[model samples]
Target: MIKKAPVGEIPFAIAGDSRIYVTAFVNGSDSLRFLVDTGASSIVLNTNSPKLKGLIHNGELADNLGTSGENSVEYSNDNSVKVGTIQYDKAGCAHIPYPPEYWDGVFGLNGLAAFNIEINYDDFKIYCYPKETLTVEDSYVSLPFTYKYDVPFVHLHIKLNGTLHNLLLEVDTGSDRIIDLNTPFVNKNNLLETKKPFAISRIASSDGGSGELKNVFFDEVIVGPYIMPKVAGAFSTLIFGMQSKENIDGMIGNNFLKRFNMLIDFNADKLYLQPNNFYYTPFYDFLVR
Candidate 1:
């Protein structure tokens, strides 16, 4: 028996530096808070979560594949993912050793790919509709995206030190920083040897892994037809994690994304952005002492 999941709206709360958390039901368990993360490949349950304890019954032991260093994890098809009344039967969940601090688990894009997901930052609500019912407002700008390793990747250009650099970046709604350039991309571009100075900051990944990166300022970042100036960016120096991948350049996080109302249509492989009240707000540079 298939339950109806035509349309629905999930309200989320912003906590701990623009992280979006929503309520979800997992494996017939009670409702628990889960972060709405487009960066995550699949539904990841925290082992430390009180409500999610012992949820990985049929999971198989495997290496935890994250941008960060590898650890052990359990991947199981014995679970189900649910948001409000919308249930995902085919969706599988993973149990990671490192748990999230603020939420019960992380809600990845695996199941969310079934709909046209819209996030209204101004209203703190996630509205989902059938892909066939997608309607784009005149105010929205559309950009095409491709799925790479279960996440959405988009092409954009950045101008730094009077040079134009075209790169492919991931739309990572889960991260709070503005931009994080991968290690290989930074090395290839000779960013560390630049005349401009940068600050060093220690960072942690979603799976409780730790790494370090250099924080720097960006002159201008061009996304689609939008030009954002004076943005904060990072040069990842981590030995492992998503930041070390050679195939991609970087990722755009919430600090850059909160400026717009966004929509992600997985079926059409399109991303839409519209300017909101938060667009003009000054960027918060955490690296600044």
Candidate 2:
């Protein structure tokens, strides 16, 4: 139920380098910030936000499995969420520790499943339209996506030591990482024995999930027609819930996603991309100076 989506554009801000979020009125009481994430299942309000006052809430916040590790969330019904030109009546959100520090929660892309969403990094705007309103073309590298639990994923080509292979990666806007290879996938490929890892780093989450990542380099990564050479890669230890899941190889995070102007057509189950100003910029490495 996309209650009142009125075709419009909303501006957003990037928090701590990679998380994209927007401020919205929560139950007409307070203006709260929420990270717009496709990987999120639904709206999850920050249980820590002081603004939680005035919003009718009564439930237990439960911990759930996540990429950084364990995550906690509580379900709530009959809420109102208004941001930009969209208003969601009878909104359902969860109470979770997300975005960290002083931010609110995550506004899941599943909430806007009825619209075609466009994200422009150049202007920092998110445009929403009624389904079937926007047009697509062959010029745009149209990548088809499959959904799992409301999150969208696509296959990417990874070249390791002259051998090219395909891996299904979750297009996760919620993560700051560029690429994180899951344990099973890494084990299946025997990457640890074959590749030289340059560094080991710890990745943390707001819900207290943290683990070490072994850093390596992919000889080449193909995103549509664009080729990224010597891309930084993280092989997960699989401590996190999502990382331990089988079948999927890994996730492509916001650091890589920000390089393109994207349009996600939920109706068509497709993601269209064009390189933005940040495309040629270097990928974030695991090293800290």
Q: In lDDT terms, how accurate is model 1?
A: 0.77
lDDT of 1 by residue, 91-188 (tens): 77877655545678888887677778888888887877786635566557888898776789988788877898888899887887778888998998
In model 1, the runs with Cα more than 4 Å from the true position are: 1-6, 133-138, 195-198, 285-289
Cα TM-score per model = 0.89, 0.89
Please give the lDDT score at residue 2 for candidate 1.
9
Cα lDDT of all candidates, in order?
Answer: 0.77, 0.77
Residue range 25-142, candidate 2, lDDT tens digits = 7776677887887777777778677777546477666555577666566778777888777788878877775444657767886466757888888888888878873566767788
> Model 1 — which ten-residue stretch has the worst lDDT?
1-10
- Report the alpha-carbon TM-score of model 1 versus the true structure: 0.89
